[model samples]
Target: MLGRRATILSFDLDYPALYYPADSGSLAGQRRFVRATRVRLFALFAAALGGAWSWRAGSFDLFGLLGFVAFAIALGAATYLQATDPARSWYEARTASESIKTLTWRYIVGGDPFPLSLPETAAEKLLRARLAAVIDPDKLPAPSPSAPTKQITDRMRSVRASSFEDRRAAYRDGRIEDQRGWYARKAVANERLKQTFTWVAIALELAGFVGAAFKAFGQVDVDLLGVFSAAAAGLAAWTQARSYADNQRAYSRNAYELGLIADELDGVSKADWPRFVDEAENAISTEHTQWRAAKGLGAPRQRNAASAPES
Candidate 1:
């Protein structure tokens, strides 16, 4: 219900949905959903191919028939279980503001306001400024003024309640922009995945060709359709893998920012601050490396100051 309320109020520019502990708490639910989806898709694809093979061969193999039946059964059962579960329905009843709960936790865990090394996008900065303005300075529970944590928590809760999605639209846009930066910066990982999968797809295609050649030479019976099916599946998997890499990079960048925030909130001793500063420098240096990589290819024209932080 709280999450639902948040979702409704999220439209207002004053409040952005806070992060919820969805990663650790509700991750199992998400994983189950993903697993079921993958299984259903794989089964459907395989069954369709089997059906076509049955027509072409003018016969059906018992194993292939059972595979198709089993897949259908699993898909039906998973869908029924998800749809009929009362708990699932109840969970869905909550408002989208639930994310605010998660974001609050990040603050409590000492996440930085935002990492300085990776400056927030212009849109992000604007969204943050807007949210900061709506927050009444007097309403803020003083962190060091002997006020209870619950007091501050409740005020944040109130803000969440009043927020509309419009207030958060720009923040979401900032997140999307940050995602693009991370993807572009992490192109090496993307390239590696591409190269790896390209080789795998090439290997599968070559093997399929070899099987076709063997059939032509009468070495053994072969279904050219099956050969094509395997090769196509390989190529499709390669494409999906590249997409996964992009998602991974986004997650990595978000995690890094959150960790930096946490470090600042924790208020490390002066002696330890140097090490933290060094880490920040390394991250900034890597960004420079990424920029240099793009120099020959019409590199970005950054508006920020070019001066590097004093080490």
Candidate 2:
């Protein structure tokens, strides 16, 4: 009973508790850092050119010295940003969180070790070992302990603890339908964002080109060229950092795969529940592991979270 309850809590709260924050944090950190760095690079480039232009035009003065100082400062800031890399920390946590989520789903649905034929204590030991394989020894950024009320606890009792029909319905509703809906929405949203960013980047680049042409013909001040160039460069940086096109593709692919799995799940039999859930969990794990790999989240502690169980 206790082991089952633990599995219940892990699925209901623990996985989410880690995944949500880490996912959001990673995106925000990387986006912000990229944007700032781009702006800094633009400023440094603009100042250097402006300084040279001023010197050659005999408008010399303190401008050249100031530009050099600004360039040095930007270089130092970039170094600091590279050294800190807040995005790396978030990526690491995200990897860990997703790995944990896969394990949680497998446990909740009685995917393997928690099969109907297994003893409760042995099932518990297997789950512990599997979890140990992925979770870091240090508890840093671990999911906060749950504080579920009796009402919540009873409602979230393990699917394994439920009636056969209830278990089937839980799988269909929670794993299949909910996942399909979520991923489908994400795919659409990501595609939309990708289009928007691509257009914005193109528009910004065109504006810069127009500004440069105007400067070349002496219709606009040379200074205006720098401003437009900086804007375009920064926008390009944002576009690259967001990687909207790649995200749209990934989300779309995952949604399609999950949709297929959801369709297959409708015909699963009670006698084949173990294999059905195992395959379902495997599908989920495969997509997420690919996601981590694409992001270069680094070699994970458990090596692709070893989506395949070890014992």
RMSD of each: 15.2, 6.1
In model 1, the worst 10-residue window by lDDT is: 89-98
Cα lDDT for residue 246, model 1?
49
Steric collisions counted per model: 34, 0
Candidate 2 segments whose C-alpha is farther than 4 A from its true place: 1-77, 137-139, 142-157, 303-311
Please, what are the lDDT tens digits per residue for candidate 2 over residues 1-311? Answer: 11122223123433423344444555566665776576566667656554544443356456666677767767775776788675565566566656656655666566664676676556655655565566553432333355221211233335567777777676677666666676778888878888886788678677778878888898865555566566666666656766777767777777788888777876777778788787777776665666667778645667323343334
How does candidate 1 fare on TM-score? 0.38
